[model samples]
Structure formats: structure tokens, C-alpha cells
Target: MTLAATIAPQLPYLRRYARALAGNQGGGDAYVVAMLEALVEDPRLFDGDCDSRIATYRAFSRVWNAMTTAYDAARDLEAPHHRLDKITPLPRQAFLLTAVEGFSPDQAAQVLECAPAAFSKLVETAGREIGAQVPADALIIEDEPLIAMDLEHLVAGLGHKVVGNPRTRSEAVDMAHALRPGLVLADMHLADGSSGLDAVNDILKSFDIPVVFITAHPELLLTGQRPEPTFLIAKPFDEDMVRAVISQALFFRTGEPAPAA
Candidate 1:
């Protein structure tokens, strides 16, 4: 297959990772653009030496670590956002790559171009430092009381306070605006047949914060839409996955520490 074809299917997710690394869509996409340019100049960057996904991330990491001044100029011109200022870069990257992005330790090590042993240390340090962050006040938006309760329990267990659990699109937006939660966990569909997407967008219009969407029909939202959420989960989601995404989202925003080891 052609290089573009090989990378195209994974591009959306790669963009997500880049956004997380850079702290915002604009800056994140800047790095992704640079990675693409580098790959275009030298197609060998995606050589079949590794799986296409791995090769793609490895190529992006090369661009990220290089941190060329031109890319900085581009991002500065785009408008700057403070991110990763408090967390150690390698540790945060390692943690996000492995924990939130679901890459195996070995795979993440390969992408980061670090020895497996060293990569382990990076992941460990990241977990400890991130877990050390102060807890955030979180908001839960779901139609199902059982699921909402479960989410509330999970949030509280993470040491974050649950500010509200709103079941409808209107309630979700209202609670979000009123309470001003540091993090939001929302279901895709609400009780009134309204969209969590709509609610989150409305809330975002009033304030900037991290959001996690839980959906039964993720394919509906995966259409390469702009303002896409970086954190998402499928119905009957894994608890570990939910916790990790929430932690990662909060980590970038509040510089919240990661959970205990």
C-alpha cells in the first residue's frame, strides 16, 4: 500500500495524540503538519520496519522531540496555550502514550526511542507525578441513573469532587455553566433525546474545560469532525480506561497529579 494509504486510517487518532501532547488542537495540529511535511520529504520515515501505526507514531515523536524553531514560530503565530509546563515532558508523554493512548509499554518505548527499562521509569515517574496533582471538581452528565451513580462513585474515588450529575442535555449544560467543573464526563445521548454533543458545545461556549464523552455509537462522532473530543469511551466501558482518560484530561488542564501508584 502507498504511504498515505497506510497512514490515512490512523491519522485521526494520531491527531488526537498530537493534540494531547501539545495541549490544544491548534498547537497539536501544527506538530502533526510538521510530521507530515517531514514524511513527505522523506518517505522512508514510514518504512515497513514496524507496524504502520507504530511507524506513524514513531515518525511523529521524531518531529515532536526535534522541536524545530519553525514549528514554534508557527504555533506562536497561531496563539499560545500553556501546557505541560508543570509536568516533566518525557514522563507525561510516556504516561499518555501508554495509559491514555493504550499503547503497550514495549510499543510506547519503541515510539519514544527509549530503552524498555528507561521507558518503564518514565511511565512510573509520570504516574507518580501526575497522581500527585490536586483533585478536581468534576461534573457527570448521563441519562442512566445507575451509570451516573457508577460514574459519580468513580469520580469521588479518584479524589475529585462530583459537582453534579445532569441527565438531560439542558441539565448538563446548566450544571456545567453554573458549577464550572474542572472536568466533565458525559454520555452521548440524554434522556430528552438530546445530544451530549450539543450540551458540551453549549457549555464550551461559556467556558473552556476538558471533556470525556461516553457513547454507544462512537462511529457517529468519529467522522473527522472539528472540535472533536480527545477522550471517549464506548458503552459498558472499562473502568480502568475511564479513569485513565479522565486523569489525563485533568492532568493537562489543572496540572493535577496522577493517582497513587
Candidate 2:
């Protein structure tokens, strides 16, 4: 396959990881653009040895770590609005690569250009950062009693209050209005045939809530078609994975109004 064809399928995921690393979409995408420019200027920077996905992320890490003029300007402009200023950048990237991006330790280590042992340390440090974050009231929008209960337990376990667990779209919206949760964990399909996407959209219309979407088919939403959730948990999720994404969503959330339509 041509280089573009090889890299095309990875862009959406790269965008997701970039956003997580930068704490916002605009900053994250800026880094992605820089990475692309760097690759265009010096194609040798793309490691031919690694798989395209790993190589792509490795390229991004170079851009992120370089602290180019673009990076500094963007960071200065976004510092007032982001919460990532407190966390060390390397640990955050390691955590996002492995925990949120589904990279194995070896692959993530490749992306960060770190030894496996060092990668483990970075992930541990990131976990500590997650534990130290300020807690907030969380809402769960799920239809399954078992799943809802599990989510409530998980949210509460993280020191966040379980404000409400709504099982339907209308109920989700109503409860969100009443509780005004700081975080929302939502399922993609509701018991009443309502879409979790629609419910989140309706709530976003009223509040700039940070959301972590949970779904069996995450690829359905991950398509690079429109604005998508920055944090996502696939179904049959590992508890640690859910915790990581929840922390990320809460960590970067600024409660600013949703972008203008």
C-alpha cells in the first residue's frame, strides 16, 4: 500500500490520542499538524521498522517533546483553560497511549521512545496524578440495571458522587438538568431505543458536561466524520480502563460552553 493509504486509517486514532495529550482538541490537532509537516519535510523521520500506527505516534511524540515555537505559543494560549499544567507531560502521554489508546506496553514504549521499565514508571506516576485530581459529582446514563449499578459503584469508588443513573434518553436529560453533574458516563444504546449520543448532545445543549461514552461498537462513533467524544470506553471494559478515561475526561474538562453549532 502507498504511504498515505497505510497512514489514513490511523489518523482518527492519532487525533484522539493527540487531543488527550494536549488536553483539548485544538491544541492536540496542532501537534498532529506539526507532526505531519515534519514527516513531509523529512520522511526519514517515519520509522520504517515499526508498524504505521506506532511509527505515527512516535513522530507525534517528537513534535510534542520538541516544544517548537508552535507548541509554546499554543501552550501559552491554552494554559488558562486547561488542567494539564499540573501533570508531567511524559507520564500523561504514557498513560493515554497505553490506557486510553489501547497500545500495549511495548508499543506505547515505542511511541514514547522509552524503555519498558521506564514506561511502567510513567504509567504509575500518571495513576498517582489521576488519584490526586479533585472529585466531582458524576451522572450515569445507562439502561441495564447491572451495568448502571457497576458504573455507579465505579464512579463512587473514584471519590465522585453518583448524582443520578438515568435509563432512558428523556430521563437522562431530565436528571442532568436537575443534578448538573460534572462528569457523565453514558452507554451508546438505551433500553428505550434512545441513542446515548443523542442524549449526550441534548445535555450538552444545556451544560458543558465532560462525557465518557461507553459502547460495544466504538468504531461507529470514532469515524472521522464530525465532532466526537474525546474519551470513550468500549464495552466489556477493564475497570482500570474505565477509571483512566473517567479521570481524563474530568481532568481536562473546563466546563466551557459547547462549541457554537
Candidate 3:
């Protein structure tokens, strides 16, 4: 089946799952829309010999899992937060179908290729694991529109909120003053020639928000004395590293030990 043919019927379920995960109405809707587009481009994952409803649910689960992983990595690189292990073999299809997508346990078990009793246990365990992670509020500052949007998606996935996207150093500073965001993810380069360092200075002058600098120019490190608690992530990074960074930054700010350097 074509991607659209596979996913169009699942849109409502996907939206419900996204909203449940996001905890915010607007953000959940946006996230589902993005995931649907991604599904259309990669439909094979969702198209299979299984019954159509089961196949659709499996595909939706996969798309959400991929997006979460990608977004988590991006966020970690930008700001270090707590390090929780990856979700294990919880039968993604069963978990989604039984829990979030509202499939009956017997039906979900069939999709997961497992027994109904086992599927129920898996769903409960996975749900508990997800509920354990506490999402932090984040501030994202990037000049690029697409990158900013991706970052927003990632932040929301982590159960965090994106306070604002300030393209310029001055605007970032102003946002920091106004929002007092828990963490800041900033590109080293801003809208003007001014570097993120300018905004960093302003934030530090007024508050103690932690920062993770995203820069394409790693060589910029050679220019001057670097700040303590220095968190620097090179651009074009995979989402895993980003998640690690964000988890580390948040943990450190919360008086936890810094993630291993």
C-alpha cells in the first residue's frame, strides 16, 4: 500500500497518542502532523501482510519511536539531562495498540506476535517507564528556521516546553530575562554578527541558567577563554548526543554530578 493509503486512517489515533505523550493540546497536534508526513515518505515500515489496522498501528508506533529517538538525541546534544536507558523490547506494536491507540489486548497481542497476557504486561511496563522520566522546561535559540522547528519538536517529546526561539543575541538575552528558562540551547552564531557568547553573558549577569552551545565552528574554541561548566556541541550531530548533553546540563543544574566528560 502507498504511504498515504497506509497512514490516512491512522491519523486520529496518532494524534491521540501524540497528545497523550506531549501533555499539551497544540504541541500534540503539531507533532502528529509532522510524524504523519514522515510516515508518508517511509511507508514500507507500516505496510505489511498483517491486518490493515494492526499494520497501521505498528507503523505509527515506529514513526513515533524514531522521532522520539531523533529528538532526544538532538536535545541531549544541546543540553545535558539525566541519562535514562533506552526503552527495551516492550513490543512497540503491542504497547501502542493496547495502550495509546486503544486496541483490545487480544488484538494488540496479535499485532505484537505475542500472547495476550504477555502483551498486557509489556504495555504496563512500558507505560510506567515513560511516566518515570520528568521532563524539564527548555529554551531554544537558533537562527535557522528548520533547525529551530526540529528542536521544538524534540523538546516537546522530552516532556519539556520550548519557552521561545530567539534568533539574535539581544532577543535571547531578553527572553532569558523574561522567561528564566531552565536550560538554553543556542547556536554559537546569532542573527547578527554577535555570538551566543553575548547572550550567554547577559543571561549569566541576571540568572544562573545552564547553556549548551551549538556551533559549526569548533575552531572557535581556540579564540578565547572558555566558560566553566562548558557544554559545547558541534553541529550536524546525531540526536543521541544531543539528548545526552541536555540530560547532563539539566542534571548538573539540579545539583547532580556532571555527566562523564
Candidate 4:
């Protein structure tokens, strides 16, 4: 079968898997698209002699693993209190199979490489864990007016508040000192060319606030070897992904061990 023909039937399943892995819908969809793009770009990865069903399953697994690894590497550079620490491996896999993909217990178990009973137990554990990790508030610091406004709307929609919108590093520092917000969303290059790192450092100097750096220059954040609780959301963003990051940050900040929503 052609590439599209082979992959089309699995789109729904892929989306479900993404949501389970991402703990939200938008991030899940992005992962599915990213996986498809990867498949298109590198056909040889799926050219194995195994059965087509098994090969296709493996392809999806590879993409999920790549995305998870990339996310983990990016997350580790953040401060421990700022990163979302709820997503464990087993539930993440079970969520992909059962929730997003609509797989039966037996089928989902097959995909996750585990027995049906084991998979069910994993799902229950993940559900309880995710419930425990949801956050109650958010912090925002964007220099651009329009982008900041959009972010505000997104945060509010997630039932969170925008504690403040500090345009400069000093403003952000002062706000963090004042509010002690549960979560902070900042732009990397601020109006003063000072960068969000300055704001983050200042906040860290005083209070333990988790931060999500939204920027056009993700490469800058990627290169640094920082600790956890600091995450990077590249510009031209997906609203859902931003929400997921914010939720994760808030959970990390509060020391609540819940998965992403």
C-alpha cells in the first residue's frame, strides 16, 4: 500500500496515543502530525520485512519515543520546581492506547508490550496520579502585546489567572516577588534585550516559581544546561501545547505529583 493508504487508517489511533502521551489534546495532535511528517521524510524506517501491521505499530512507537525523549531533554534543562514531573512511562503508554487510540484492553496491551491485566493496573495508577497533579493558577510575562493577550486568553480558558504581565526583567522580578505566582509564562527576548533568563534568575533569587519560556529562539534555551522546572515553548505556538506546559509547570511548583491534563 502507499504511504497515505497505510497510515490513513491509523490517524485516529495516533491522535489518541498522542493525547495520552501529552496529557492533553493539542499536544497529542501535534505529535501525530510530527510522526506522520517523520514517516514521510524517512520511508526506510518503516521498510522492514516484518508484517505490515507490526511494522506500522513499530513506526508509531519510534515516533512517540523520539518525541518523549526530546521533551524530556528539553524539560531537564529547567529548574526542578518549574518542570512538570507527572508523566511516568507506563501510564503514558496506556493512555496512548486506551484513551486516545480507543483500543480495547487486549489490543492496547499488545501495543504497549504488556499483558492486559498489567496494562489496566497501569492505567488506574496514571489516572489517580494525573488527578493529583492538576494546578490551580498561572503566571504570565510577555513583552509583545498581541502574543501576551493571546496567552492571557489561553491561561484564563484553562481556569487559571495571569498574575502579571511584566514587560522587562525588573518588572517580572518585582511581580514575582509580589505575587508568588504558581506558574510563570515568559518571553525569551524582552523589550530590553535582557531575555527571560534574567527574569527567571531574579525570580529564583527570591521565590521558587516555575517558568515556561515562550520564544522565537528555542535554540538558546536548548543549548543551556540548567536544572528542572524551566521549559521552552517555541513561538507560532499551538495553544493546547502551551496549556499543557503551564499545567505541568504549576504542578511542579506546588510539589503536587499529578500528570499533565
Candidate 5:
């Protein structure tokens, strides 16, 4: 297969990572486009020895780093004193590679072009940064008792309080309206066949809230057809992934808006 064909399937996922890492769809997509153009000009930039997925990400990393550095330089020249506007993206990128993209530490290290030990350090720093985030009340919308309990524990472990766990869409909406949670962790499907999407939509209409969807089939929601959840945790998710995503969602939404790439 051609190089384009080999990497085509990974583009959506790359876009997802870019969007999350860059903190907006437009800027993230721009970086992905630049990376693709660069690849067209120099195909050998792709590492043939590694998995195609890893190589694609590695190439994007180089593009992101280079472009962002240039962006920072220009911004610095324009406003030398506005240092607080910058978002420290490296730690978040490392966290996303392992937590959201499911890359192992070694593979994520290759993507970042860093030593494995260094990558571990990056993740550790990311964790500490995430841990320091302001606590927020969270609502858990899951039908499963065990999963709901697990999610509650996880959310609580991060110093956030769980306002409630609702089993159905109606209950979720009602609870959200009554409690006005700062965060929502929801399953796509509920026991009553009520859609979590519907409940979330109702809640969003009432007030703006950061949402993190938990589902087994994340691809179903990542269709790129409509506005979708920016944060997702796959079913049977590890504690680390849940913590990272929860912090990421809250960090982006509650924290100062990330300056556009």
C-alpha cells in the first residue's frame, strides 16, 4: 500500500489527539494538515522500522513542536509579558499518548522522540500537574452498579466529590439539574435504554458543563459527523486513563482557555 493509504485510517485518531493536545479543533487540524504536507514533500520522514501508527504520530509530533515553537517566538515578540497565556503542552501530550491513544510507554517515547525513562518523568509531571487542578463536583451516569461505584471512587480519589450516580437518562438529567455538577462522566447507554447523549444534551441546554463520556465503543461517537464529546474513557478503563481524562477535560474547560495553538 502507498504511505498515504497506510496512514489514512490513523488520521481520525491523530486529529483527535491533535484537537485535545492543541485545545481546539481548528488549530489542531491545522497542525495535522501541515504534517501531511510535510510528509508529501519528504516521505522518508516516516520511520519505516516502527509501526505505521507510531510513525504517523512521531511525524506529527515533530511538526507540532516546530510549529508551536515558531508560534511561541512570534507571540513572545508581540507581547513579551503575557507569559500566563501559554499552555505547557508537552506533559499533556505525553499523558494523552498513553491515556487516550493507548500507546505503551515505549511507543509513546518513540512518538515523542524521548528516552523511555524521560517519558516516564514527563507522565509523572503531568500527573502532578493534574493532581493540583481545582476540585469540582462530578455526576456519574452509569447503569452498572459496579462501574458506577468504581467511577465514584476514581473521581473521589482525585479530590473531586461525586454529586450523584444516576441510572437512567431521566434520572441523570434530573440530578444534573438539581445538583448542577461541574463535571459529568456518563455511559453512552443506560439500563433503561435511555441515551446518555440525550441526557447530556438536556443538561447542556440548561448550563454549560464539561463532559467525559465513558463507553465501550468510542468509535461510534467519534464519527466526525457532528459535535462530539472531547473526552472519552473506554470501558474497562484503567484508573490512570480515567484520572488523566477527567483532569484533562476539567483542565481545558475550567482552566484559562488554551491560547489557540
Candidate 6:
């Protein structure tokens, strides 16, 4: 396959990482576009040893680090600063690469040009930093008792109080209206044959809050056809992924200090 073809499928996923890391879609896509341009200028630099997807990310990391260093020189390329960036540089990247993108420690370390042990520390430190932040009230909208309970546990573990777990669209809307949660986790399908999307839309009208959709239909939602969730967790998620997205969503939504990259 041609280099572009090989990189094409991974581009969307890479863009997702960029959006998360940069803290906004536009800024992230700008960096992503620049990385693609850089890669086109010299495709040979794409590391052949690692997985192609990982190699592309490694290259993007280099570009991002460079752009960050010379941000003032390229003012148009600067990304929005958020509190999450304050946790330090490599950890957030490492955390997202592994937790959000499902890259192994070895691969994520390669992306950051760091050692595996160092990468592990980066992920751990970021977790602690995020966990230490002030918790907020949360809601869960899932038809399955198990999933709703699981989300409730996760939300509580993060020091947030769970306002309620609703099983249907009406329940979700009703709970959201009454409770006004700061965070919400919704499922794409509910028990009562109602769309989770509609439920979220109704709740959004009532109040603006950070929402994470844990769905089995990730491809349908992430196809770029609809407004994407700021933070998304696919079905069969790990705790680390949940933790990372939750931290990111809350961090980006609030008026907190996001350190210079």
C-alpha cells in the first residue's frame, strides 16, 4: 500500500488523540494537518519498526513538541490551554495514548521517545493529579443495571457524588432536570427503547454539563457526521480510559489554569 493509504485509516483516530491532547478539535486538527504535511515532506522518517499507527503518532508527538516550543513564532498554531496541561507534558500524552487510544506502554513510550518505566510513571502521576482535583456531582443513564452501577462506582471512586442512575430517556431527562449534575455518563441504547441521544439533548437544554457517552456504537457516533462528544468511552472500557476522559472533560470545561505547553 502507498504511504498515504497506510496512514489514512489511522488519521481519524490520530485526530481524536490530537483533539484530546490539544483540548479542542480545531487546534488538534491544525496540529494533525501540520503533522500530515510534515510526513508528506519526508515519509521516510515514519518509523518502520513499530506499528504504523504508533509510528504516525510518534511523528505527530515530535511535531507537537516542536510546535509547542516555538508557539510564539507560530501564533496561529497555538492550542487552547487547559488545566489538564498543568499535570506536565509527557504524562498527559502518555496517559491518553495508552488509556484513550489503547496503545501499550511500550508503544506509548515510543510515541513520547521515553522509556517504558518513565511512561508508567507519567500515567500514574497524571492519575493522581486528576484524582486530587475537586470532585463534582454526576449522573448515569444506562438501561443495564450492571453498566449503570459500574458507572456509578467509577464516578464515586473519583470522589464525585452520584446524583442518580436513570434507566430510560424520560428518567434521564427528569433526573438531570432535578439534580443538575456536573458530570453525566450516558449510553446510546436504553431499556425503554428511547434514544440516549434524545435524552442528552433534552438535558443539555436544561443545563450545560460535561457528558461522556459509553456506547457500543462508537463507529456510528464517531463517524464525524454528528457533533462529537468531547469525551467518549466505548463499550468494554477500562478504568484508566474512564478516568482519563472524565478528567479531560471536567478539566477542559472549567475555568482552571492550563499551563503553557
CA lDDT of each prediction against the hidden true structure: 0.75, 0.77, 0.61, 0.63, 0.77, 0.75
Compared with the true structure, what per-residue lDDT tens digits does model 5 show for residues 120-181?
Answer: 66765665566455567789999999999998887777678898999899999888888878
Candidate 5, 13: how far from true, in Å? 13
**Distance (Å) between predicted and true CA of 199, model 1?**
0.5
173 in model 3: Cα distance from truth in Å? 0.7
The superposed Cα distance between candidate 5 and the true structure at residue 11, in angstroms, equals 15
| Weakest lDDT window of 10 consecutive positions for candidate 1 | 73-82
Better of 2 and 5 by lDDT: 5
TM-score of each: 0.54, 0.57, 0.47, 0.50, 0.58, 0.61
Root-mean-square deviation per candidate: 8.6, 7.2, 16.2, 13.4, 7.6, 7.4
With candidate 3 superimposed using the best TM-score fit, by how many Å does residue 58's alpha carbon deviate from the native? 31
| Candidate 4 residue-wise lDDT at 253 | 48
How far residue 212's Cα lies from its native spot in candidate 2, in Å, is 1.1
Off by over 4 Å in 2: 1-96, 99-106, 109-128, 223-225, 256-261
* TM-score winner between candidates 2 and 5: 5
| Per-residue accuracy of model 3 over 1-261 as CA lDDT, tens digit each | 565676677777666755544444565576666656766676566657777777765655566555644333222222221222333444333444443455656666665557756775665444334333544556788999988988777566555678799999889888777777777888878888778877788787876667887778766755567643367777886443454455445543544321221
Candidate 4 local lDDT, 70-119, one digit each (tens): 34422333343212235566665654454434455566566656776777
Give every collision pair in model 1. 130-257, 130-258, 131-257, 131-258, 131-259, 132-257, 132-258, 133-256, 133-257
Higher-scoring candidate on lDDT, 2 or 6: 2
Q: For candidate 2, lDDT tens digit of each residue in 1-261?
A: 766677779899999887766667887888888888888898887887888999988987888888744334235435433444455778778777876688876788899998977876776566556646656777899888898898888777666778788989999998888877778899999988989899999998886878899889899899999988888878887665676677767655666523333
Model 1 clash count equals 9
Which portions of model 6 miss their true places by more than 4 Å? 1-48, 52-90, 96-106, 109-125, 219-225, 254-261
Highest-lDDT candidate: 5
- Stretches of candidate 1 above 4 Å error? 1-94, 99-101, 104-132, 254-261
**How does model 2 fare in lDDT?**
0.77
